[model samples]
Target: MSDIPPLRPLLIERPEDEGAETPATVPPVPDLDIAVPPPRLSRARNSALTRFAMWVFGALFSFVLSVAAWDFVTSLLARDSLLGWIAMVLVGLAIVTAVALAAREMAGFARMGRIDSLRTNAIEAALKADVKAARGVVSGLGALYSARPELAEAQVRLTARGAEMFDADGILGLAEQELLGPLDQAARREVEAAARQVATVTALVPLALADVATALYSNLRMIRRIAAIYGGRSGTLGSLRLMRGVFAHLAATGALAVGDDMIHSVAGGSVLSRISRRFGEGVVNGALTARVGVAAIDVCRPLPFRTLPRPKTSNLVSRALAGLFADADRNEKVK
Candidate 1:
């Protein structure tokens, strides 16, 4: 090996040399920018520790409340048996109600899980071209929506023609066209409504952080409704899970931020940006909401977009903001 050279500073230090200048840091900017973020649930740096603390503290607090209740009931009993008995019964009922609510939450989670498994099974069957498994998936889908009067005709049609299809793709595709067609339309409507709401609020609301709160509320409600539309019937916790899943997918795919594609699609040529900056921010926010809604549909829908076409974020945003765009154009022309 040849002689090795040691690393050295670019300039030699000298006692008499003037003090070197420190590198300047970039100035901090506000998060509420014209190109906005659809609000995300923030996490602590030590997320695991935070979760542990939450559960431990929750359990201790609950236990303390329970002990206090029991003591109060016992003291009342010692004072007067009738009032104590009534209070005891009321407390017991409350406990039972809480247990029932908890059970309902668990059931909601299980329902969402069932839909997920159903989707997974459908994908597998479709890929393998397994007629039998596809039929099973169809049967499950039918059963899931059997209670709905609106699906009665679709259900009957599916059951009658399902036996005729010999391949998985055909079976699932037909099921898609029949069973999920109307449901898809309803879900699309929900997404549009959410996108419109988000865009309108973001553009008009001048208060700091107001847009963030509105976006969160609208997205959460939209997601929950979409889940219900797809037969997920998600409860509070289930809805939160769906929200996390939707946003996480967006983040993982790096689709969380607005891009050139979204900008062109939303405005048809950056027209919104020229019309009004705040309105432009609103438009971007609305587009992001549409993206989130589409992702929610993907997560909540039992079947993948193998047969049916998935909703495009562009198309949805364009239609959602058509009225707003027209209004903005009219105002621009008036000026």
Candidate 2:
């Protein structure tokens, strides 16, 4: 306080020597660039319209083809001539073949669609713990359960139990364990067997084309078998739909990447090394087949896994690859 001439009261005023700077305050502008998603109904409507268009086009094309065929037959022969009679006979056979094929395809489509609808209904019923709906869905699966009498009996018992139980979870759990469990096991085994078959074909068939054909045949057979296990028993069209569903599930679960990696790990070597190439291709194809099989199980399961954990893709790939390598090693040692 005694310092020379007590320090003048600390001046706190802005210095006049320099211009004062002020921060520019910006008013918040409303965001005009934000994107709003379209309504879901619009998208659904578009999809339905597209499907309708496709159906219309298909019908029109078939009609045109039938008319063209008739015209060609008429131009090729007089109606009274022997050649004309032969042509008519041939045309009749062709028509019968076409009709039979169309009927088969249509039936398959209907059956596959029905199975999908039934599964959805069953899942919903189980979630809601609705005894009547559950019973209805189970009864709808009679054709499927007929193939396995034990499963049919289990369904009957479950229906009776559902009537007694109040908890949705309990009823669903029992149903899953009693009814779906065997089908799951069977599907898993089918996939494993198909993988092994693919591996065997890949290893034994020297020709690439032959290997490709056999692999395709094996996969188709596997799909059919899986469909049958689920009580679908799809024909060619139904099988195609089943395969499509499987692929969709694989994509949804990100299993496709795992499957691809496994295949690449096994098949990345040069083709010039015949023995190695064959083994690698076989392992790769087998892994792919296994992935497809797993997808089928996921798609065909009547209910979503609430208590049970879904199978991990990595685990599946690991097991498939391990089995493949072990088999290869054993075979080599034997040789």
Candidate 3:
């Protein structure tokens, strides 16, 4: 058998094999045609609504004023008959105005209250810091002075009287007056020692506390400074005097406390005489107590509820009237 004989079909050409478009193909995408409203109409509508609301308000306001004016004119023409009515209306308006003014003033006063509290807090903080520094200084001075109190007392007395005790001319002159001759070698050494002690003590103490003490020496000083700030200067002189007396009493008490603290500190520390020699008994007694008192006094000073004297009601009324008159006078001058 011959296996070479197989029948093959003829080659056919397909038009779809070429990259040509067929008759059944759909068309490409068409351009979009959207209809948008004009923005000018929306803006115009908003403006028209706003104008209508404003016009309505203006018309209402004008109508109210016109009615009030008409009534006012009618009452004036009927003067004798409507006098009471006009007065009543006037009083009503005055009352309303007064109430509104009072409300506004009350709001302002409330704000002032907050500011006052803030100022008080600031003053308190500053005072505390000052007191702490002063306590350390005074305590150190107390220790130095305690070592030789006789000399310290003399110097303190001189300082109180505002004498120039520390200066070379003052010291030499005073020493000559007290001793009545040139200092012998031993006497000179003793005077030198006392002078040195005084200097040391003064150096240790704060000048600021001294400044405060000098500023507040009398009732007059206290009243002037305090009353000015608080707006109650009418009875300032009496207030100042009372405050000065109180301070003096307190200072005496403080001195006693200082002595007590010194005695306690010395006694409590050690049973041995050697221990007592270094830190005396008075040291502990006032050491903590005096500082505590100072802290308490500082805290009380700036409080709103102080027990200061008040002016009498009659006086207060007179003062108020005077203030009004003064204001009227000033207004007249300005005009």
Candidate 4:
């Protein structure tokens, strides 16, 4: 302490500090230029009031439109009898078409319900091992497929061999083999096709929200077609229900995610991962679509996948994107 110098306060200052004056307002913060985040699933909630409001509005609008149309037709008729008759006829035709469309939609829902009933019956038969119930289920299955001209031969084969079975397992197993085999292939093809389309569109299209729209449309069509293949033949609303059910199951089971399966499925293991960001995202979207397809199959198939193995996401994705990479490579070489 004796050898040390005395402490002193020192203020360091720049030469320009005295002349530089502060501005009236603070300077704005600089942007870091970080990348924008990927879009997430919508989490908007619809309250009961919101739903009721929509229903009320729709009803009022529909009533107003109908009244206006009726008034227009009646006024036209009052002015000119021939023109009025023509207008009336046109309105009658429109009403008939509307009725027919509603009937068709109802029938579609009925068909979807029928598939569900068959699935339930199948589960009961399997659980109880009831031969009688199994036979009934098989009969219903045959009847269901009889309308499809493509399955006529398979139905015949099912009918011919279905009588000899004694045990419940054998009867349903035979039905699974004969009747549902072709349908399974048909459904798998649909899944692969949809996955391929989704991946292709996502990889190539650079527009905003393009992948989202493609995935939604592709998954919807895929579900509807898969339902049709299983004799559901769902209409727009039925298709939406099927889509919802499939996604619900996925959510409940925590299957709504990507995994190592994606790496293995798209373009020869990990090779495609390094190719392009768009291609990688495309693979993920496609893989998810394939998952939805599998779930749709489970929802729509009359009998559960007992004899036939359920499709794996990786296997479906591999087959789907195999040709995609080949075409991409060709394009690169050509360019």
Model 4 off-target regions past 4 Å? 1-67, 268-270, 326-335
Q: What's the lDDT for residue 309 in model 4?
A: 75
Candidate 3: tens digits of C-alpha lDDT, residues 1-335: 88998889989886665556677664653322111110110011348778999899989996996678667756775776577567657757866896777675554344333323433443343345444333333233233234453446544543343233333333323322222121122222222232223222222345545422332332233233332232222232334333443344344434223333233232332332333232231222122222222222221222211122211212222222333334433554576
Per residue, candidate 1 scores C-alpha lDDT tens digits across 267-330 of 6574665676778788888988988988878778888887778887788998999888778777
lDDT of candidate 4 over 1-335, digit per residue (tens): 49989989998875775556477554754322121121111123589999999999989998998998889888998899898889889988998998888898888877877777787788789889999999999999988888788888888788788887788888999999989999999999999999999998999999999889999999999988988898888666666667777777666555567765455546655456446778778888888888888777777788877776767767788898888887765665677
Candidate 2: stretches off by over 4 Å = 1-56, 72-80, 147-150, 209-212, 259-281, 306-327, 331-335
Judging by lDDT against the true structure, name the best candidate.
1
Model 3 residue-pair collision total: 13
Better of 1 and 2 by lDDT: 1
lDDT of 3 at 39: 14
RMSD of 3: 38.1
lDDT of 2 by residue, 1-335 (tens): 56677557786877684455545554554312121211111012348788999899999998998898787778667555677667778989998998898898777666666666666676678667786776666566655576687687777777787678766567666677667777877876777777778777887777758877877888778878877787667566667767777676666655444334455445333321434767766777777777777677666554555555555433454455566566556665688
**CA-RMSD of model 1:** 12.7
Question: Per-prediction RMSD in angstroms?
Answer: 12.7, 11.8, 38.1, 16.0
**lDDT of each model, Cα atoms only?**
0.81, 0.65, 0.35, 0.79
Per-residue error at 314 for model 3, in Å? Answer: 47
Worst 10 residues of 4 by lDDT: 33-42
Candidate 4 total steric clashes: 1
